[model samples]
Target: MRIKRLVQKHPEEKTFWKNDQWFNVYVQVNEEKRPDYKSRLYGEFDRFGFEAEDKYASLAEDDEHNGWRLFRRFKMVLHNNKRLTKDVTVKDFCGKQMTAFPLFVMSIKYLREHLLQAVTTQKIGIEETDILYVLTVPAIWDDNAKRFMRDAAVDADIDPARLKLALEPECASIWCETLGTDVKGAVAIAGSQYMVVDLGGGTADVSVHERKPDGSLKEIMKASGGPWGGIFVDENYMKLLDRLYGEEALTDLRKTEMSDYFDIIREFEHKKRTVDIKNTKHVIVRLSVSLRDLANKYSKQSLEERIAALDSHKNAITPKGKDKLKVDWTVIQSWFKIPIDLLIQHIKTLLAEPKMKRVQTVILVGGFGESQYVQDRIRKEIPDDLKYTYGTNVFQYFDENKYPDDKKVWENGKWQVPFCFKVYVRVNEQVKVDQQMTKRSTPNSKISLTAVYRTTQEHPKYITDPGCELLGTIELENSTDIPFEQQRLETTFMFGDTELFVKTKNKTTGKEAYMTFECFT
Candidate 1:
């Protein structure tokens, strides 16, 4: 298939609406009703949208959280711990809490319920298994992370067979397929290659794709990204607050009026994105009255005096009328500098690769991608090789072609299914990458089930043998409504990279379905 499958995800907004109205994912659990964030009691959760995300600080400091601690950025376990087993219990950063898993389950359930509710409201009947629930994750996430996400979906009452984990950057680019090549100085169209930089809240996923002659985009370079996201800017802004507000006062406010504290931060959040590269005027932000009062109570100094005490060349933060603070453009720019620098550096290295050389348009997509400051910095800092205007003009979308380089070896179209089922890798098997991915193709009258197994004994004959254990199943259904002769399944088992990507296309319908298989080695 020339183009990858077009699964979907969020665009460059708090929640970009796919079908008319936006379905928000920022879930705010009613901590008042349930003190436990890890409660498995699904469908009882509250709103999860921008308002909930903005209220995260407040939720973290609720009175009920006195004994337990709140954890953020809990997704890093997959990357940090390479020895992590699928069944191993995941703990918090301090290795104490078992809360992240259940939290994930709750979030997934809430999302599913909301989606179902939206459909039901329109008087539409949808089967749970027939509807493939797509969950987009950072491309930097490895196999373990993918497994964790899949397990969470399973726990959320979703069938793993119907679940599809879409890479975040690919989701962004695939969503842009309809962004026709009508823009000025356009290079992205049918057959041209481009790069997708998905800058989300905490991670930036980068990938390159080429539009095939059949209108399907093929992945040239797999996923490469880092933790250089927009949240880093928010962190720097917090550091600035700690320095200016006095850590004691800030800490006290976080303990007492966290909602106000979050609002204070969100005030800067709103202002930061608006400040552009050419912005020369001071960005004005309305300060929370509680913050200003607490600053004086704890610091024993007024806001004006604190500004005066700074030894810098110019005052980055200035006191405006009563509660408003006029922040310098320089300060906002500095907050954006480090993360954007790291992100651009990563892009430069990605572009330097042989396969990546043909990439012309660098489409920036995500919530962070909406930042005028981030976009402006990318335009100025990155090399001229990325000349096309990102996020503004070039947004292409389509089905994502993952593991595009996995070549399928078909032998004379004679017999592949019968042999594939009987194929075996000896215990302590030592075979090349090419051998593992090779499989023959033939039309089947019925669906085929390719079961993967792991055995303890060196020579185990059947799955019912003493040491053999069923690990996973890869199923191939007819690609489209077609005759047995018109169907062809391009099956491949890619190992060593830690997963299996199976591609099948119906010759008559020209439809393709991707199946990913994950199992214990």
Candidate 2:
């Protein structure tokens, strides 16, 4: 049977999941006005126990009187397992004794960046109904972080109930649920566990589950995270480069002369996170010249010789335009090997416990997890009895074309490997119902056919005679082609019980505006 899925518009704002291969739709009310950015950050700060400087009468008075002054410089919220309660008497303008709650804000940049991502995602959708998911560390629990998430829901035009804020660990749990696997513990580890490790950036998070008689998995332990990740290693490498190049010389080079040159270096580092690199030589040379130029006052090394060395050292790293820049993993490994060895030791310690040993599988997750060097190292170091799993490695069940020779087998169109789950996504119907059913925004949607599919396992046995059918992935296109002053779209993919929604919105009036939908099954 031929089926077409029309996610009319604003797929960016919706969430998706795959079930008996049918689409379940949910709509979001995209807000018309931009929220007061400062207020939202204030809400987060307040939640984190960072009190306004207004707590001090003089500072409070100054801020109130000075309209243009941004009174708060930085704010942070930290979670503590301890409880402290204190009340202080302060005199108000009315000359009455008032009690004030003392508070402090945590200035952690990482936490601040996350709050910004959530806020930006809420405001900048190309479509009104775009869906976004933000990742967070599991154990770094803080009340203010939760408050920021709550504020995001309040600021959004869509039904606040539809927006979700998940601990990185919990998202992993949801992924496990999506995969339809109960193997949280032994013999097989699934996608969610791996996602947590990735979110953590470096730490290998392990979750154990019990396979029930009906074949569902239960939580063993959520997973642990550490500050050790590839980014941290990158910083270490930057420091090493500075030391090797001579620190003082590098700093002088960065400050005075060619500033844009250093920016390119950071760009290269950012590109490295996305793919593998086998070399970094020539790029380093260009950066070296830029740095030297920046130090216009001094010439430590003759420019010609330095440039020559840099060009000659083609062994530094290889750049692949955008996808990836290559760097010698061997050199990087040599510098970081001791720390990597130390990290492996810690992982081994956790895994060596009797309960951990019962873990059937170990999964590599995060950007670093994708590193060919790391993978090779882990495989070489691991005992023969242990094995690793990657999401990219498990594609055989879903797309045979991608893995034409995938050894994994499906019985009756069902994966024997277990953990196979469904995905579902939802977005709003084109029509809007305020107090009365009406068109709030111009109907901006398109309709098209894309080969879509869902596994038949989640289907009810009584409803249809079923084994497994390749329910083609429904590509959404609006048939009416209703034009909105602002065009937006949301697409959802439901995998098992959980839903992932992506949404994008664009101003139709903008000079450069065109709509296109790229759907993948």
Give TM-scores for every candidate, taking all chains together and pairing residue i with residue i: 0.60, 0.39
At residue 19, what lDDT does model 2 achieve? Answer: 28
Deviation in angstroms for 357 in model 2? 3.5
Tell me model 1's lDDT, rounded to 2 decimals: 0.60
lDDT of 1 by residue, 352-415 (tens): 7777666656778888888987886675555443111000001112113521222223334531
**CA lDDT, every prediction?**
0.60, 0.37
Off by over 4 Å in 1: 1-44, 51-98, 180-188, 311-314, 384-521
How far out, in Å, is residue 148 in model 2? Answer: 6.4
Reference-based lDDT, residue 403, model 1: 15
Instruction: Residues 195-297, candidate 2: write the lDDT tens digits.
Output: 2233234443444444445555555565554444455556656664453345665655433332343344456455444334444322222244545444333
